[model samples]
Each structure stands twice: as C-alpha cells, then as structure tokens.
Target: MSAYRGVRIADFTQGVAGPMACMLLGDFEAEIVKVEPPGGDRLKDHPGYSAWNRNKTVVTLDLSVPADLAQAKDLARAADIAVFDHPPGDLEALGLDAASLRDGAPHLIHVWMPPYGTCGRWSRMPPRHSLLAAISGIAFRQGAHGDSPIHLILPIGWYGQAVMAAGAMGAALYERGASGQGQAVTVSGLHGVSEVGGVVMVLDQPRLPRGAPQGASPSYRLYQCGDGEWFFLATLFMPFFRKAIDALGLGAHWEVLVLNPALALDVLEEVFRSQPRRHWLGLLADAGVPCAPVGNRTDWFAGDAVRHAGLRLEFDDPVRGPLAMPGPPARLSATPASVRSLPTAGPLPAWGPPQPRTIGPGASRPLEGVRVLDMGSVIAGALAGAVLANLGAEVIKIESPEGDPFRSDGGPFLTCNRGKRGLGIDLKQPGAKEMFFDLVRQSDVVLDNYRFGVRKRLGVDYEALRQINPRIISCSVNAYGDAGPRAPLPGFDPLLQAEGGMMAAQGGDAEPVLHTIAVNDVATAGVVAFGIISALNARRRTGEGQEVITSLLAQSLTFQLGEVVTWEGRPPAPSGGIDCVGLSPAHRYYECQDGWLAVAAETVAEAEALLTVLGTQADPTDALTAPPEGPLAGRLAATLAGRPRAAALDALEAAGVPCAPCVRGYEAYDDPWLAENDVFVAWRHPRLGEAVGVRSYADFDRTPGGFRHPVPDAGEHTRQVLAEFGLAPERIEALLAAGAVFEPAAARSHLRDGGAALFTQ
Candidate 1:
C-alpha cells in the first residue's frame, strides 16, 4: 500500500525547499505535474532539480500569455494540491491566487512557501536560507566572538522547512480524505529556521556557556587518538560521564571530574591520545558510554547502521545515469517510501492499492481515531506528538506535577503545543501509577524524550507497558542512540551539534561552535513523527506494535552529509570555517555595493561565463587558489565591490549564473515576494495583541485544519482530559485533592471538550 498513491499535485515551486516537499510527495507515489517557466525553475538544470523532481511530468508555462495562464489554472483546478514558493501576489497578478481558485475549485489544496510570511514585521523582506540562518542565530552559535557567522555547508534552513512542509502536507491530504473540503497551507523559511533552533531562543540559554567555548564536558566531545582518527563522545549527563570515567580508568579523579571540565579534559585528552579510536570506541561501548567515530560522509555510508536502517538509496537514471543519495530518513515495513529515476522507472516506484481506512464518525482530520499519550518533554519529542495532535489525534500531554518547564518558556511552547490537551501528573506519587496505566491502556502510542534509560527507571519502558497493553507503540527520543558509550549520559541540542561535527564544520578547529537552532532536534522531530506514522502503518498489518528509538546524533549526521563525505581508511578532516576556506571562488560569497551575495559555478566554463557577466575576461594563465579558479575571480570580486546589488544580480542572472543576493530581511515587514506566497499572518496573541505568525506548511483538498486554539496554560485541560478518560468528576476531584494530578488553571468554561471542539473554534 503506497502512503500517498492516487494523489495529484500541481507544483509551481522553484529552488530547493518547495520542490523538495513536492518531491517527497512524488516519492510516496503522488502524481507531480511540475509547471516550469520558459527557462525552467532557477534550479531546473541543477542536479538538485533531478533529485527532487522524480516521478513527475514537466510542462512549460509562460503565465504572461493568456493561453498558458489558462492552461496553468486548468492544471491547478484539476490538482488535489497546488504548491508554489513565489512571494506574495505573484500568482494574484496572473489571476491565480487563492481567492481566484476558491470558487472554481474549492477542493484544491493551495500551499505557499515564503522566506518571511506576509503579515509579520519581516514579512515583506525577501531572504534566502543563509540569511534566515543568520537571523535565527544559528550562525552566531556556530562561531566564537570576533568571528563572522559561518553559513552551513548545506541549505539546512530550507531543507528543514521543507521536511516540515512534507509532514504538514501528508496530514492535510489525510484530512481531505476524511472530509471533503480543501484549504490553504503556508510555511516560511525563517520560521522553519526559528523552529529548528528554537530551543536556545525559547529556553533563554546563551549561545555558549558563560565563559567557555561551545564544546561539551570532557567525555562528550571530539577526541583524536594516536592514529589521528577522531571519534565523538556524547555523554552529556552524569551517568554516562561516570561510565566514561570508569572505562578510562580515571575513577580516581572523580571529585575534580565532578566540578572541573577544564581539568577533566586535560586528563582525558592524554588517555585518549594514547590509543587508536577503534580501541577507545570499543571500550567505551562496552562500558556503556554513547560514542561514535567522527566520520565524514563516506565513513557514514560505509557504516553498518545506515545500510541496516535503509538510509542510503541508489537509483539508476537513464539521463543522469547512476544516482545515489540518502533514502527517506525513515523506514516502514508495510508501506515504505521509494525513490526512482525520471524517464526511466515507470511511475517511479509502483505501489499496491491503499488499504481501506476505518474512519470515525464526523471526523474532519487525518488522525481522527488515533489516541496518543505524549509524555514528551522539552523540544523534540513534544513537537513530534504535537504534530500528531494537529493531525487530529487525541493527544493528552502528561507533564510532571511541577508542570512542563516549557509552559513558562513562551512562544516556542505555545506554538509547538498549540493543539494538544494537557494533564499534569507526578508518576512519583504511588497513586498516580494506576491512573497513568489507565491512560496508556487507552492510547495507541506512548512517546517520550527522556534520557536513554529514564523510561526504564520510571517503570514506563516498552516492556512494562506491553504487559499492560500488548499493542502499545512505544517511542523514545534521546540525545544519542540507545546502545552506545554515551547512552546513559544526558545531552542538550547544541551540545549534540558540537559533538556531531556541525559546529566543527562551521567554525573549524579554533573553538567548537554551536548551531543554536537545534537543527538536529528539529529534523529529528519530523523523523520521530514519521517513524510513529510508519509504526502505526506497520502495526495495522502485523497487529503487533513495536518500539521506535531515535537520537539527535543520528539526525545531525544526516544534516552534515553535504560537508563531509567519509570513506574507509580516510583520515580525519578539520572544519573549514566560513571564509571561503574550502569553496571555489564561484561558490563563495562576494561583496557588493549594497551588501553580500553568493554564487555557484561547478565548471570553469560556467565560472568564466559568470565572470564575463561581471565585466571581467577570464585569463587561463592566472594563478588560482581553488582548483579551476579562472583568472577573472579577483577582478570579478573587485568589480562586484563597486556595483549595486540589483545591477549585479541582473547581469549574473541574465548570464544564467547561479546566484542570489544575501539581503537581511529579518527586520523588514514589506516584501511583495513574501506577501504573494501567503506565508505570514497576523495571528492574535492573547497577551501580545496582534502578533505576526507563520502558518503550518500544508494545504488539504478536503479538510483544511489548523491549530485548535493557541497554546494552553499548563494544566488547563487537566479536569477535562481526565473526564474524557472515563474518570468521574468525584474521582478527578479526589485525585486533585490528593495532589496526584494537577490542574492549575480553570478549563475553558464555554467550549465542549475534546479534539472535536476545534471545528467550532
């Protein structure tokens, strides 16, 4: 059964993010009708377009012509969904905006991707992914003071935003299937960047530790062994730290290890350098520390984990020949995601007919009948369950008696937890155990992001839960994998960034930089949500639920693959920081009269052509710093320095050079591009009046769903949620009196309780 078979998407997206969302839909057997301009999208000739546009038919449509405009509208009217990334009003000028189609094809799903959305302070300014990265503070976290913010080796902000869009679309489609209406979905690159790295901004954590650089404590960072091979230690918590100490025979220095990271690093460094990475990794693993080799892309591919997990994929394209890339970062037994070569594989990967669904009565969302017990904390796991909630799952958030620390953290919490129900309980109270087990018995799944073994410690591990309800799907999220050297240790998002080589890639060897965006955690949230959906799909067939485990370490590796390709026998590589250290002149940033801009030209001829547009002639005999660096680079740089950004952009684009102006739009509130895309909205924040917000990244043809309401105050739903779980009012009152369960705020007085209330709201 294909996950998205029979779905038809009319895509008018350009560049990486929007195209990638529709591409994933294609991977799942959705029909993609990609409408390109005369010259094609900005990346039509680029390899990425191929990577993302598989299983699709392409058509050229010049919207300026009345005939082509009619044809494009016809395609949109016929599609179950239409996706575009153009800024505000671009489609409206051509009479193809939301209002135009709403009457003719009310069932059409209209989705728009923008840099900044339409109504926010920054809505009108156009920004590329790099600028979003900088505004999100991810760059600031990537380097130390006096260092200019380093851009990531990959378009992480865009990709992360796209992944979120894919999930949003999937949910929308599912909703449409249940209902019979369609509506708009909007996702913004800047907000996506903000969500991924939001842990720092939301938690009030500094970019780095007070005075120290961004590296972790002694046993949880990169260490080079005698062979110069490097491996990472991810023991962020004390238990894992103890294991590292015991494994390294440094138990005698427990007191200093307890308080002094500097002293401990010195001691551990000497011991680590004395042995090879393999030996230390083995010993650390045996000692129960979570550790993995500091490998590049090649090493990662060669590792046993990816192949076993089906993370790597290969497709033989007739036009492009053999093309290999990482497969979907998830796996499902019954309905797995597939990849294919364009014009080669027939319909990409063919799929079995979808199994008939068992929809609940009066349902208007994809996950209408599903129930989830979200015991998630902080960012990753909570967000994962929140995805389910927004999809119409009955999610009851189980917070501690003290409340989710996040309820006080502000927007990150409110936005992430907007649609879910909340209940506060202290499992430590003996009386609460049965109540939790009761909730578990009714739930289809249980999710958490506790430290590696906290579920077991709390007697809520999969095995124990299975004893109560055999079909319960158990999912656990952590900083590191479950069975490694640092498994028992605790970790934070940026700490994982530092250990997993992202910071190193951005900041180089000086001091470990951190990407505050929690890129790993954000991507991992999507992965977790996908994994849960996959598990649910599998369980439907097997009638047996299984445990799903994921880690920040694994996700960060997937994100870092663009910068580092590792192989067996490869020596360790240092991060080449953001100053064009490893990129070609064409791929590097250049100064312009107004600001900065970036370009990419893989071949010397391409570079030469670009230089010509910049008014410089290429000199074959000139010395070059990067390979194939034509003589015109230095001269082109000097010329670009004097030209205003718009003029330079016009020339380069006319010459077909791959480039974009790096404008700072984080503070701007007016850009026609964003307004046309419908990415921004003036959301009403109860306390802040009308505040700008980004919408979810999906549109549905049937049921256009959104957050039921703004984030609830912690314990606001305690009484109501308990009543739904079959508890009598007296029982709820008794539990409240006993202090086993908590409800700090009054339940909304007027609304009928349960997920169904969202329709009325």
Candidate 2:
C-alpha cells in the first residue's frame, strides 16, 4: 500500500509472532531493518521464515558486542517503530528496553512481545509457542470428546497476537501524529491465547461437551460421501439450515430434526452417504447451503478461487528458488497492499530526528474519541468491532429489530460483542434508515459481515455510506474476497477449514478432522481490525477514508503462512494427523504418570537437554527430526510414561527445555500468575448476570485499554446511545413509537400487541 513508505522499523524480534508482525508492516511498504544475530533468526531453519521475513533489509549485529549494540541503538533512534521479542529482562539488561531506547528517540513506537507476559510468573520462560499453548489450557480445550489434549501444529496464539500487535502499532502511530510522542506496547502469547479463546475462557459458564472428532453438529460439521471424500456442511443460520433440510427432502421431519439434532444426524448421514462429494456439494450450493470439499493446502493453493481472488503470489527467491504462497490477508482499495520483494542485504541506516506534524486532539487511549458503528453480526465481523472498542473507540452495535441471531449463542456473543453499546433498529424502515444515516455521518468507521451483495441490498454498503460521510471508513468481513468463484457463496469457519486444507492437515492420512479452535474466524477478526486501523492511519494522512476488506478464506491461508508456501526444494512443513498429538517427537504432547505434558525442543541443544532429563541415550539431532511415530518418540514416551507431570516439568525447565502441563477446563484462568496480570476481567451482563472474558489483546503503557462494560443486550442502550449522539429524548421516543428503533424491555408490550406485524408487512 505504501501507506507506511517513509516509516522505518527496527525489527529485533524473531520466531513467529514478531517476524509475522514485521512482515505485515513491510507488506504496507514500511522500511524494515531486520536485525539478526551473526547466524540468523532462531527460526531460520524453519520453512516459513522466508515468507515471514520478506520485504525487509537484513543486517547482522550481535547486541552483546558493545560496537554492534551502539549501532543497533542508533538504528532504533532513527526508526519510526522498534519491535523486540527478547526474554523479560534481557533487553533491559542490554539497555535496549523501551525506556532505554525511547529516552533518546521520543518519536519511536517500541513494541515488546513476550512468550507469556512482561510480569507473569512464566515471564522468564522461553518463547515456545507450543509450550505457551499447553500451559494456557488451549491444547486441552482442543481435545475432542474430552480426551487427552491435542497438541496443535499451528501457532494460533502467535499469529493472532501478531495481527493484534500490528493494529496496536498502527493505533499508536496514529496517536503519535497527534501528540508528537510514542508509547511502549506489549502483545504476549497470553494475549494471543485469549484472542483465540475469548469464547471459551469464561468464568462460571458451563463447559460444553467436546463433540465428535469429526465435527461439532449435524448442520455444522464434516460429512463423508459415497465416494469416500468429505465436505463440511455449515448451515449455521436458521434460513440456511432450512434450505439444507428442504434440499435433502427432509422438510417433513423439520420439527423432529430441530428438536432432536442427534437423532436427525442418522437420517442426514444416510442421505449424504448415498451421494458422491461432488453431487452433495453441487446440490447444497444450488440450495444456498454453505459447504466445501475437504482439500489439502497444495490443492487449495493451486485452486482457481485463489487465482481469481488474486491471493496467490508466485516469485523466484534468490535463496528458495521458485515459490508460491498466499498474499496479504486484506484489501484496502486506495492503499492496496502488495508483495514488493524479498529481504535485501543492507547496513543499518543512520538516525535522524523524526519530522513533526501539527498536533491533533489528545486522548487517554489511542482511539479514545473515535466513534464506530458496528453493523456486524457473529464472530468474524463482530469481534473486529470488539477489538476496536477495546482499543478505546466508542463502538455502537446497530442491529435489526429482531436482533443478531448469534445473540442466542451466549458465550460467543458475549466474547465478540463486549465493550459495544447496542441499538436495535429496522434499517428497512425509512425513519430508521434516516437515523442510521445520521450515525454514519458522525461515525469514523462502519463494520459488517453481510454477504457480498446483502449490504448493497440494504443500502448500507461502502458506496452507500461514503455518500453520506466521505470520511467514513467501511470495513467489510466476508467469507471470500469481493470477487472470486466462492465470493457469492456463504461461508463459516469450519467450511473454510474443510476447503483450505486445515481439516486435511489435522486429519493426516485419515478422515478430515475439524480443529476445535475457531482459527479462521478469530484470526480474521485480528486481521480485519488491523486493516481498519491501518486505513484510519491512511485517512489521517490523506484526509479521506477508504474501503478495507478481509475474509475467512484469506485468513484460512494466513493461518497456514509457514506451511502454505510451495517451492522447488522446500522441506516438508510440520503437520498434525489422526493422532492430533503434534508434528514431531521433540515438539508434541507426551503422557506422564498423572497427566499430559507438551514439550518443545526446537534446537539440537534443547533436544539434547530433553533427552538428558529423560535419561534416554539418543542422538539429539536425529531424534528432533524423527517422525511423530518414530523410535525417538517411542523412547521419550516410554520414559515419560513413568514420570510425574510436575517432576518432568521441573526437570525439563531446569535443563532448559520448554515444557508445560496441559491444563484443563477454566482453571488456567484462575492461575495466580494469570490473575495477577489481569488476563481475565469480570463484569455484570444485562441478561446473563456475572461474566468474564479475556482482556484487550495488547498492553499499551501510556494509553492502556481494558474491559469497559458487559455485552449489551439488544437495544439495551438505544435511548442512551442516541442521546449521546445528539438525538433528543423526544425524538428518540418518536422513533421508538414508530417502531423504527426499539428497546427489548419497552418494545415487549408493543411487539406483543401486534407491533411485530410491522416486520411481516
């Protein structure tokens, strides 16, 4: 996009989250100076390193050396942003912590990413993504049917945190343009875990039973066809569910199907198994039911949809030969993102004072005074608005008179709609449409996930909104991009998992398996939020807003960034299988005397230490690379099979190997360390009573954000929100009387007394 063309970033981070964050910034044409050790990043041996480190200048400098350290400080002083992923106190010891570096560079935005958090009990632990996932109870939650934890091959939290941190960086940059100053921010593995687990990491909420290994429900899971191929059926909404049943000629059994879904699965299964995958997919698509065939990353990467969507990028890297991978996850119309080039060799750039811009309005948080109209429903779009609200924006969620259908999904609704005030209005009603247009004129951004053509039908699409307020930034989240074979179709997270190879990868050689975590949905939220913030920053510079688009399909590819790339000599990327345990012997979950423990030994040194602790005689180099079912895993498993979880964890930690117990249930949120850091917050909901959810995704030292209020019930704040927007009480009452706007409590009588007929007419 070149939105950040003149901005320079000093990237001192390594591994997944830090490198991915810097890569996203680089994609926007920021000048990234990647500072590595004499050898390279710790992840240099990994396959995705090339993709994550693209569009940057590489320079080697050891901070332990006084001369090199001085040069690093000089580069940090000159850059607009400096990112780090060093251990808790390592940077402070080297005089490169935020305070140390920012003392001389007041305009530099310093971002520090820790494995756990800056002040948690595990703060000193190594930056191991798998271990973090294990300790946080995420892995345990992934176990289908309440079995032992499944070690996820994907670093879900890291990627989620990366996108969140990128957004935070953008917000800080925007704020700096006003205050002529910078701030320190933190996006840790804990934040990443919370980002993905927001829907489940709740206090007092009854735990949902882990579903079948294949899928969660009949209308929202994978199914096998006559030809032995599989596809996901995602009739998540009522209308889609009805279409699916009617298409299957099961309309007569609708009542029974809805009341006893488990029993209906048998009938549906028989019907689906009677046909081939192609037959079902075609039949379902014609009926408007969201479905997709199970496919691997290779097939998806080479698909026509990816090509038509302009999501496939092919380039010949000087080091990696010919390569193909997915492009950036979002589309900004005016400042469209692009893949410029690979990392180039260069020396550190010298420092100079940053140019100053005229000061703008100041606030307690980066986006304190910004107003947003959240016209989104469900996870992807709704969570994007929640993120902005958490960042200090005043977000008002606008729903139809009937309210968001997802509100019935209590936990997910609470998670995604937190921090937003709610208003229920009938946009199809002329009076309501005028009231919304008034909101558009006063709002900085409007977010939605209505299908490609639905927004236009409602007269609230980007073009429609721009006409009302030229400065209104429209952020739309869709299943696919704006133009593609799949763009017109409906989609859900599991459908993408089936279509984009996640199910295939997780299933290994067996039937396609659905990963319990909502990886695509959650990641898309972070990605869309980042795009919105970036677009806002661009607007600040150009004095105009633009359309920013993201999709579940794009995020599906993004979640597999490291593995999706194809090159002539690329090594096989790590993947999970039927076991769902892990990718390799050195980086999987092992059963102990009491419980399961996740171990991560990425380096030969760490592998050697792991073997030493297990008292196993094996070559660490060979053992680390052995297949999950190989002799090395067998030996480690045999030894660990007798050791207590705590003792093994202690020995592994003492020996410098990263490991953690697979915590179960919501107990991890109550950990003293997590509680001390306020990883979870508590508030009272209007209908659900007491509630808890993860805190904001990142920590900004000066402009920090936290839980402001509970999720609003439909129209809960209609009167108050309108008053704040300058609407008088009498006008609001007239709108309510006209049935244009509504409050559930106040409208209950009216609706009961035939006001509901207004919708039917």
Candidate 3:
C-alpha cells in the first residue's frame, strides 16, 4: 500500500509549484481534487502541467463569485489537505483563509505557496520563477557575474518549491496518523530557491560569496575536445585528481597546472582537443574517472540509458495522442509507484498492517520507531540523513576519526548535518568493522553516498550487512547509477550540470556557464529520502529488506523534464528555452527603468491582453510564433523601460499579466513574509551563536520539525552513542585511548536540552 492511500487533497493551485506537489502525492496514491479557475488551470496542455496534473480529477471554480467560493470552502472542509498558490488575502477575502479554515476545519493541512513566504514587507509582492532565481543571485552568478543579471530559461525555483512542499506534506501526513490534526504549511519560492543552492547559500548572519566568473580550478571546469564538444572532469579532490591524470596520461605539466590553475585551462584545452570527445570519454571510463559527452536536448532525451532506466514514460492519450513525460524518479521493490488514468476512480490497493520488525525507540516524530545509521559524506549523502532526521528517525551519523571531509566546508555541512548525533570512528582501525556491524544490526537502515566500489572494498556492502541483519535495508547514492559503463567514475554536482546539458541549454550560443549552486546534489538528496520512505513502506507489505538506489543522473533528468525533448529534423532547437525574442516576447525578461523583471503570457488570451496593454496593433500570433527576432519584443522592452519597476508591475498585474521585478543578493531575506511563519529563522548555536537557519519548509499540526540540537562538533555523541549501543564504558575508554574513535572535550550544550526528543506528539 502507498503511504497516502486514503488521504485527499483540495488543490486550488494553478501554476507549477502547487500542482507539482499535489502530483507527487498522487504518485503515493493520494486522491486529489484539483479545483481550477473557470477557464481551467493555465498551462493545461503544457508538458510540465500535463505531467504533474496526472492522477488528478480536475474541476473548475471561480472563487471570486459567492457560489464558487462556497464550493471551494466546502472542498477544503472535507479534504485532508488544501493546496493553493493564492496571495495572502485572496482566500481570506473569500472567507477561506487558514484562520477561517481552522475555525471550521482545524484538521485540514492548509498549504500556502506565497512568493516570499509570509514575511513582513514583501509578502504581498508577486513573483515569477525567474524573479525568484534572480533574487537568489543565481542568474547573476549563472552568467552576468554581478555586473548585470540574466535569467535561467528554466523554472528551477518553482520546481524546487514544489519538491520541498511535497516533502513537508509527506511528513505531515505521517504525523496526522498519530495526532489526528493538521496545521498550516508554508513554502516560499525565495526559501526553496535558496535551499537548492545550500552549498553556497550560507546559514549564518553574513552570507557567502556567490560566484567566480572563471571557475576556481580548470581541472574541475569544462574542457572541449577535438569535435568542439565539452566534457566535464571529475577532479574534485586528490584521489580523483590522481585518477584523472593517470587517465589523461599527463606528465610534467601536472604540478604547474595544479598550482597555477589560471594557466591550466589553455594547456588542458589543447590536450583535450587532441582527441575526439568519444576517445576521452572512453579513456576516462576505463580509468574510473568521470566524464560525459555534452549534447543538446535531442541528444539527451533520445539516449538509450534513460529509456533503460525507466526515466521515460510513454502513454497514448485519447485526446493528446502519444504523450511522454519524465517518470517517477524513485523506484521501489514491492509496492511500486504507477501512473494511473486521470479519469479512473477505484479503491486503492489493499494495505494491511505492516509486518512487525525491530527498531530503536524514538521521540515524538513520524518515524519515531525508526533508527538509521548514516555513513554518508558530502552534500547528497549528508542531506539524505537530515531529511530522515526531520521525520523523527534516530540518525547516528558515523564519520572517520578525523571527521567528515566536508565538515570544514562551512554552509553546506551546517545545512545538511543538523538533526543527528555524531560518532567519529576510523573504519581503517582493527575493531572498526565489528563496531560498524554492531550498529548495523541495531539499525533499520544504513545509508551511504560513497563512490561505486568503496562499500564493497570496505566489506560493508549490502551483501555483507544483510548477512548480519536479514531485515536491514541499505540505500546507496552515487554519481552515475549502479550498473552502468560509467558507474565507476566519480561525479560532482557541477560536473553533472555540465554533462546533463544544463549549461548548454542555459548558455545557448554564448559561453556556457556553470550554475554555482549545488542543485543536482540537493535534489538528488530529496529523491534518496523518498526512496528510503518507499522502501520502508514496502517492508510493511513484505517481511523483507532490500537495497534502494538513486543517482545524480536521475535528478538531472527530472529537473529538466518538460523543457527537454527530441523532435524530428529540428536539430535540437537551439540551446535555451522557447525562443522568447521571437516566439515568446511576453514570457521572457524585460528591463524597466531601474532594473530587469520577468513576465510571461503563456496563453493566446494572455498574449492578447498584454498586447492591449502595450497598445500594439501587431497580431499577437506574429510575436508568439515568429521564426526570428520579433519587432513586438523590442516594442515591449521599449514600453517597459519607460516605467519604473513598481509602475510596470502594477500595470501588468492589473491587466492580469504575470510579472515580477528581478531581485537579487543579500536582499533575498529582506522580504517580510518569512517572518510570518518563521520560514527563515535564527537558531542559537553554541559556537556560531545566533546563526541563521531555516525551519523545515513544512509546518505540521503535530510533531513539527525543528533543530533538535545545534550542529554537532566532531564526535559530539561518541560516548553517549556507545553507551546507548550497550558498549561497556571500559571498552569505549580503551578505544578512545587507542585513537580508534574520537571523543569531544565536552557534550554539546545544545544536546543537553533533551537532544533528539525535542519535539513530542
């Protein structure tokens, strides 16, 4: 049985974020009642809309009218959750706000996706996905390098918001099973966008630097081959660098190039260009170095690997003919996720009580009875642990005696390792293997994000651990997936961005830019968490355990789902998005007197309305479907430039045209909306006192998630963890004396305040 089989959602969201979140719930077998506006939800046939809106029953309602408003309120009263992207007062004006809903339906989870969250000053200001990206400083770091800003042609910010919302909703659903209550949940485009870039997005009072125009190191950047095709390298650290040099067969220039990265690019470029892309790929693959061929949308969408991996879904719709959408990113062994017919209404699969199993006792969180042993490193692995912790799993993070290599990475580490007890033990030590196995025996699951072969080489692979505890589920994450030709090669987030065509699709004919944010890593982390949940659910159906796997490749595909495709004879259709200068003047960025802003007219009616606002006689179709740069684009830009951002926004919004100003940099947190829900809060840290941190983007009725303790110092819980695991005090002391494990100077003060049991139902 799916986790949310009997749950029902009242979906009033029209655009990307809310619909996407509800769609994910639908995948988990939740029933969705999607209430669109009278004309139907916008972007109806658009790939993103169509794909996400699957498994939903759509109905139209005009909340502005008394009758329709009453109808929406009725749905809200009956639903387990209500989702909407309406501004702060829209529902209240219609007498259906959270406060009103609480009065009538306190058990309903009211999810609101405000632009900046319910912060102070800018809560009411509108936002488009590009505007969110711009405010995140992504566009500036993505290409313009701070002098000017450019928008990413994709709706990443909006998509990320949806993922965060879905995660929160899942946790809330679990909590509701115990509490029989629901609370208001909030996710802002601004908060979601910042989190997608957590590696660079600081959680302290001050922020980190955004981007370097030229990459910090040539070895880690793009290199073009003889065919003028760029292939990314896997040279993030010393081991990877050694492997890369061995594969390239480079000699004397290694030292000079490694020390002097400014001079490395020209030398490496000339070296790479000596061979065709395929030759280098072959060499890298053979030597266990990560590299991939750069291609256009056609090249990526038509790849054999994607089809084999079930990342592609094809269905013959009666009205829309053949339809293909990116399939669900995670795969489960027992009760798999399926794409159901939109019109079908039937009883969900029969789900009985789960088979009993042993697990550690937990505090008042959703996964209270679950115990997880986290042997993960870096962004993807560490983040998966954090997500699990949010659900009330007792996560014991096992690191080396020297600590996780990424502990000093600052912001990323702080963001991904918060809700866990830390134990530092050297896996290379004599008794380390037995100690790890003992923990595994007690754990319900063990998770890691090491390279493809590391676990096997260390004798801690699934096959080895399952021998000790037959009911243990092991989840592993890697660069390329499990069993591929390129599986052995290591992967980094930026490298995947380059290999996945994000740069090419982003830059077009211009110089390709690397997104400074670690989007793929963070996104993949969420998918991993989802996989763990699915596996746990599967265990309920069958008294067994299994290995679950996900990869960066899967997330990259999911991220660019709607925009990427292969069309016959179109030569992959340039690089970026729909040709906005010619075909979508109203859907691209435009400059006002003071700054740039994003606007979109996805439908003909909206285009016509925008044309009316511009007072242009030119047919809207000409601008919307032109083959070359349209005159209407210039006209719109000119008209927009004459007005200030506020006036232009006000005018466009009055006409019902979607638009927002391009906001960026530290100004990101200035919006007042976040204060309303504590979306971005400052939790006290013992070391970094009063450091900034974000609460889970979700707010629950019961068992709401927050920092149980400050981020732990190395080995913060070593003694406590050993004692809890039934290890003798003398044995622990001996190990500590032998330097096999690390013991901190003192127990964390934060942990002294009840630690993992901070939130109770």
Q: Model 3 scores what on Cα lDDT?
A: 0.67
- The TM-score obtained by model 2 is 0.95
Cα-based lDDT for every prediction? 0.62, 0.81, 0.67
Ranking by lDDT: 2, 3, 1
Q: How do the residues 309-378 of candidate 1 rate in per-residue lDDT, one tens digit apiece? A: 4555666655555555555554443455677546222221222323334443435665677788888865
Candidate 3: TM-score? 0.83
TM-score for candidate 1, please give it. 0.71
In what order do the candidates fall by TM-score, top score first? 2, 3, 1
lDDT string, candidate 2, 62-163, tens digits:
988999999998888788999998878889999889999989677889999887776755677777777777777777666364467776777888888788
Specify the poorest-scoring 10-residue window by lDDT in model 2: 752-761
What lDDT does candidate 3 reach at residue 457? 97
Q: Write the per-residue lDDT of candidate 3 for residues 60-104, one digit (tens) a residue.
A: 777788887877787787788888787767767777777787675
Whose TM-score is higher: candidate 1's or candidate 3's?
A: 3
Between candidates 1 and 2, the one scoring higher on TM-score is 2
Best by TM-score: 2
Model 1 stretches with alpha carbons more than 4 Å out: 37-41, 44-50, 57-69, 115-128, 135-137, 199-220, 265-271, 319-322, 332-334, 340-371, 386-395, 399-434, 440-445, 449-516, 530-720, 733-761
Ten residues in sequence with the least summed lDDT for candidate 3: 752-761
